[model samples]
Target: MVIYVFDGSFEGFLTAIYESYYNKEKPDKIVAMDDYVENLIDRPIFIETDEIKSDKVYAGIKNKISTNALKKVYHVFLSEVMEAPTVIYHYLRLGFKIGNKVDLNLMDDWVLRMDKINQQVASEKHRMLGLLRFQLVENDLYYAPLAPDHNIIALMANHFAQRMSDQKWMIHDTKRCIAVVYDLKEWIITPIDLPAPPVGKEEYLYQQLWKEYYQSIAIKERRNPRLQKRCMPVRYWSFLTEKK
Candidate 1:
């Protein structure tokens, strides 16, 4: 069996697809270099990322397939699932044949899997947008930390950058040790290892007030832990000021 290995980048995956088409060699699997494990029986072909090749593949996907398909493909990639590369490879192969209607073929295993992965990434992005909480820190910087299931820090950062364009903020994905930092002018994603800074006195007092308000507004007789947990999962409570 032949396995195509890439550098775990979107560009690299696209390059692999380009190679697969031109080489006319069907690979049994496509995986990121970091995720690949050597097996005695399998022949691994490491595909280097080529901007020209990847760009051609990308444009083909955009023109041959629908723009929506391109978005779904990107979202599925950000899911970081173990089988994502292989899934994307097969999904694109089918997409190219069927054109824009490939997503309609929900019966196909790869299509269904890709759709599900895309949905998962989209759900997390939506949830993080509302659930993300920012705390005022040193240099008047607003810092928020989270551990989302998907690699969606960039998506969330883009949203906040537009809404809070006047303020400086940072959203840290503790799970991945990366952060999206936004200055008043622009935003950027970068690797980070810093601890949560201490909340200032005013911020502490504000948090306490907010928590008190949260409790005050709750009707003890109508408390519904199950419903509350469903709306706001327990996993996110650690970072919420009121929950703290």
Candidate 2:
């Protein structure tokens, strides 16, 4: 069986799709170079990323398929799931064959899987918008740190950039060691490794007050641990001021 390997990039993945069609090869699997493991049986072919080819495939998806399908494909990539490359490949293959109605065929395994992954990425982005809590750090910068299940820092950054347009802020995805930083005008996503910056004295006092207020407003008699855990997973408590 032929196995296609590509650089761990969206462009590279799309290039792989382009190569598969041009070369007339039906690869059993399409995986990132970093994720590929040598197996004695399968033949691995490494496809170089070509912007021209990738762009053509990208435009074809947008023009031939629905724009919403193009969006779901991108969100599936951001999921970082090991099976994503192969899944996206098959999903697109079907998309090209049936046009926009590919998404309506939920009975198809690839379509269903892609839809589920897109939903997961969207859910995390939405939840993070409400749950992220920022603290004032040095230089009057607002810093919030989180470890989300998906690579959604860029998506969240756009939301905050519009809402807090006048404020300088950084949202660090500690798990990924990357951050989306906004300097009041524009925002960027970059690789970074940093210890959690200390909150300013006033910010610390505010946090304490917020935590106390959280407790005061809660009625112990109506407390439901299971429900609370479901709504706010325990994994996120470390960065939540009130939970702390």
Candidate 3:
């Protein structure tokens, strides 16, 4: 009963998969960075993974398995789920074992679990895309901060890239301490530094106007805090334009 332990990162998990199949040992168990096997009886393998060479593992999936299957594999990782590395490894193992064709049917335990994880992450991303309100900072960069339950920051990139393409902006996931930056030319993930000092009058005016429009559009007499809460939960109000 060989067990494999990996850091709780997509690349780390990929390294585990590479190790899991790359070696003749055929490890019997797999788990994330923090998870520990309860009843350990066999040789244990622990891997401190690197993202660079792990691209080879990812390439194997895209090259060996169909490219479309790669999408399913990534969704499982992007899920930001507990014990996600275990689930992704299970999915990949099945993919390789099944060879030519791979079907992700909900009836299967692993498939169902991955599907549920995808839904959870996707839901959070969609909600945050609209709920997120940015602060216009010095040098005309829009900065919005959020702490999502899932790793939906990557998921939110394209949505904002398309919507705010013409503008220079940044979306900061405070929870992760990383940010998605769009500088009108292109979009890339970046690390956050500090409080982006306020941009002069123009930016402040836009946010102020947006806030005013938000307040003005609401019909006070028909306001229902309960209904609004149900629609846009209070958890996201910190950066919601209307809520603020």
Highest TM-score: which candidate?
A: 2
Ranking by lDDT: 2, 1, 3
User: Residues 179-228, candidate 2, lDDT per residue (tens digit)?
Assistant: 99999889999999999998778998999999999999989899899999
> Between the candidate structures 2 and 3, which one is better when assessed by TM-score?
2
| Backbone clashes, candidate 3 | 0
- What's the lDDT of the predicted structure labeled candidate 1? 0.92
- Give the 10-residue window scoring lowest on summed lDDT in candidate 2: 19-28
Predicted candidate 2, C-alpha RMSD: 1.1
Better of 2 and 3 by lDDT: 2
Candidate 3 global TM-score? 0.81
Q: Which stretches of candidate 3 lie over 4 Å from their true place?
A: 1-3, 24-29, 34-44, 48-53, 99-101, 219-226
Candidate 2: residue pairs that collide: none
- TM-score, every prediction: 0.95, 0.97, 0.81
